[model samples]
Target: MSQFALLGKRRFAPFFWTQALGAFNDNAFRNALVMLVAFQMGLDDHTVSLYTNLAPALFIIPFFLFSATAGQLAEKYEKSRIIRYVKLFEIGAMVLAAYGFYTHHTSLLLIVLFMMGMHSATFGPIKYAILPQALQQGELVGGNGLIETGTQLAMLIGMIVGSALMEIAGLGPLLAGAITIAVALVGYLSSRGIPEAPATAPDLKFNWNPISETARVLKLTGQDRPVFNAVLGISWFWFFGTVLIAQLPNYTRINLGGDGSVNILVLTLFSIGTGIGSLLCERMSGRRVEVGLVPLGAFGLTAFGVDLFFARPDAALIHGLNWLAFLHSAGGWRIVLDLTLIGVFAGFYVVPLFAFIQSRAPREQLSRVIAGNNILNALLICCAAGFGLGLGMLGLGVPEIFLATAVLNALVALYIFTLVPEFVMRFITWVLVNTLYRVRIEGTQHIPEDGPVLLVCNHVSFMDPLLLMANLRRPVRFVMYYKIFNTPLLSFVFRTAKAIPIAGHKEDPQVLHQAYDAIDAALAGGEAVCIFPEGGLTADGEIAPFRPGVEKILARRPVPVVPMALRGVWGSVWSRRDSGLGRARLPRRFRARVELVVDAAFGSEQVTAASLEARVRELRGDRA
Candidate 1:
């Protein structure tokens, strides 16, 4: 089903709109404040700079002070109720905003900004934590995509509408404030329709001290390295985003030589492009949490970012041009494409990381993990801002900053990919599997979520292990002949996955004994291990006779044996066909349909070499 299908269900739709509306209001209010302080009020340069700097600071400081507490609250209370209360807080904040706007009270308005930030901090944990409760495991990537798409688009629209509304002749601030309140009210109403999301840690005691709790929350995030790294990756994305967003107004004015409309046009293109990429993730990723796409995103960010540098030079001049004039100017279309692709890649980069974190983090601590991510994200954003300031102080222009960021993006991505080759390995596997053939996995749920199991399957092709490793939800440690395990291209994958390499007793009694020992140890430790009972791939695309190795392994460890079969790989290019590689050549099939059928596990006492082969043959039937 399309991820959009979630919108039709009460489990998701209400919460989606509520979150979108809140993002919209936040951006709207901030941008309107910016417009009023910068362009409309005729403040001096220093004063304008002061408010511009203070606005973001005021908005983000609360996250540092409150996210730890908010994480605990989300864990201890019904999330939907917390959401309702946060919306109430937003309403109260908007009320204060209304009074400040009407009375032109700058202090009061800044206070409202701080309140709105507090409101966002309060919702941060609940917003992410509630998703796992509302969404199924398979739906997580799709759901996260939709949420991200909504947020970017909402931010774009809200900024435009809020600033435009506030610029009206008389009662401008009043109208903007009213709209903000109205949006907040509707958001609260939408949140009411959300189904209940019970707390994952209801009995947890709340800690009142922000200092110690914040430290504890951060420490909690580090408990899972992959998850914490995902958080860091996400924070890196925000760092890039913060820099680009902070630079946009100045970039549009000085570099692009465009007016306000062109600025909006740029923002719109980037936002919409990101939405498109976010929405496409499900299909491109084959409906899985594909971290492979993250590297693809990183590549795009650098490639297009560098292209943007060349597309609009520092020397270009088109002063005060409107959107139309800017588009008609030299290199205008290229600039637009660069910005759009940058956003698209940003979407690809961020959505998967979010889904991965959500799916992997422990349910009980998901909120606290998200809160830790927020705190780190806030810190990284500040660092990004500092970076831009340092560059500016060094006599760098905005475009130069883009170039520098792009170069840094490449270096950082390489560092990250090197640190975690699994991401790159998965990306490669996903691409090859997706491109080489259509693969369907049946009875995947038969694979236990945990514990040891001996997986017995018919060896059909050279790619059997790759197929099973790539597609199966659970990790499977395969026992294979050492020679096959050491195949040139597949060796890295095998070693990285830690596949157990064994040999025939006559050929290498030592290796065979070691393999048996390793298998026993793995099972004893509650790890899943798979073995091909056929001992080797089928030369003619038929199941090879079952070997005694399966019986021996079972006798030693006595674990559940899952019988599996691969169908429709007989004549494929990768499979051994005709007599020899240099003779009897024939046309190779492209993207042949392949099915992996898994049957219910045979209880330890029920499985034998003969029974597993017979069951697999039955499952394969005539397809073999």
Candidate 2:
């Protein structure tokens, strides 16, 4: 089913609107307050500046201080109930905000701002942790895409509405206050439809001390090296976005020589591009959480950020113009495309990381880990402010900062990818499998979610293991022939995936023993292991004789044995189908339709060399 089909379901639609409405109200209030302070208030420049700058700090402060407490609450109680309470708090906060707006009381409005911030901080854990429980693994990526798209679109609307409302005569405060209160109340009503998401760690003790608990939660977030790096990648995204979005106004005036309308235009393109990119993630990922998109996103962020600098080189030549006028000017299309594509890539970069976190993080503790991510994101936003400031102090222009940020992004992405090679490895495998062949998988549900399982398949080409690794949700450790395991470029991927290399007994008895030990250890430790019972790729577009090694392994440690067959890869470029006098060559079939058919699992005792081969042959029929 298309992910959009989720919108028609009771389980998803209500919760989605509640979250989106909450985002709209938050942005509307902030933008209204900013507009009021900037134009309506009869204050001097210094006071206006003081209040405007302090607003962001007040809003974000709760994320740093209360996120740990919030994570604990979500874990200790029901998530749906927490969300309702959060919505109630929003309504109360908006009431206070309404009164402040009517009274023109700046201090009261700031307090309401802090209250809204606290509400968001308190619900941060529920926002992410509830996803895994609410949707299936296959739907997780699409669900996240919709959330991202909604949030960005809501932000755009709220900003525009909030700022526009402040300019109206006589009834501006009444209109703003009424809209916020109504939205909050509606959000609470919407929360009513969000079915209960039971607590993940109900018996977990609450840590009242925010400082210690915050540290502990963050430590847990880093427990898995890959998860930690993914978290870092996400935080870095917020940092990069903070810098780019925060500087857009300055960049417009100083570099693009554009006015307020042009500023809105740039922001619109970025947000729209981000939404477009986010929506495309599910499709690009083949309806799975494809981390390969992460590398692709990082690459685009750097490439376009650098290009944006050159897109507007001579800002002095232009003067203040409206968005339309700016577009009509020379080189405008390039600038707009740069902004839009940058946002698109940003979407590509961020969506998968969230999916990865939700999918890969320990389920019971997912909320706490997300809370830790929120806390880190808050910190990164602060650092980005400092980074932009440092650049300004050096007398560099905003465009120069853009250039510097792009350069820094490249370095950071390289460092992160190096620390976690699985991301890059997956990218390569996904590219090869997704682009070079249209792989169709059947009986994926038959693959066990946990515990040990032995997968036996007929190998058709050198790319067999990679194809399996790329398509299967669960990671597999392949038992590969020794020489193929050492194949030059492919070896890096095998090593990173921790593929076990086995040699023939006559060639190397010690290697064979070690390979057996490795297979035994992997299964005993409760991991999926795939082995080609044929012991090698087909030499003449046929299944080689099934070796008895699988029987030996099953005898050593019995597990559910799954049988799979590959069809149509036999004539592919990766297969050595034509060989004569020790010479071999590949067919020219690229992007072929290859079918991966998996039969129901057989008991280890039920599986034998000959019987499994017969079943696999039947599954493949004449295709192989």
My TM-score estimates for the predictions, one after another, are: 0.95, 0.97
Residue-level lDDT tens digits of model 1 in 1-624: 899999998999999999999999999999888878887777899999998899999999999999999999999989999999999999999999988888878888899999998998989988888988999766877898999999999999999998998889887898999999999999999999999999899999899999999999999999988788888889999898888887888899998999999999999988988898898888777666778788889999999888878887585465889999999998899999999999999989999888888877988999999999999999998899999999989998888999999999999888878877767777777777777889877886787767898888888777778887777765578888899889998787788777999998899999999999999999999989989888887876778789988888889889988888888877765677644455442456668799999898888888778888889999998886
- The clash count of every prediction, one per candidate, is 0, 0
User: How displaced is residue 260 in candidate 1, in Å?
Assistant: 1.1
- In candidate 1, the residue pairs with backbone N, CA or C atoms under 3 Å apart (3 or more residues apart, or in different chains) clash, namely none
Q: What tens-digit string does per-residue lDDT give for candidate 2 at 1-624?
A: 898999888888989999999999999999999988888888999999999999999999999999999999988899999999999999999999999988889999999999988988998889989988899888998999999999999988899888888889788888899999999999999999998899899999999999999999999999999999999999999999999998899888977889989988998999999999999999888777889899999999999999999988556467788899899988889999999999999999999999999998988889999999999999999999899988989988888889999999999999999999999988888887887888887877788877899998899888899888887777899999999999999999999999999999899999999999999999999999999999788878888789999999999999999899889988776786644224344336778899988888889989899999898898888997
Q: How far in Å is the alpha carbon of 53 misplaced in model 2?
A: 0.8
lDDT of each: 0.87, 0.90
RMSD of 2: 1.5
TM-score leader? 2
Q: How accurate is candidate 1 locally (lDDT)?
A: 0.87
Worst 10 contiguous positions by lDDT, candidate 2? 578-587
Give the candidate number with the greatest lDDT.
2
Off by over 4 Å in 1: 450-454, 524-526, 551-561, 578-587
After TM-score superposition, the amount by which residue 109's alpha carbon in candidate 1 deviates from its true location, in angstroms, is 1.3
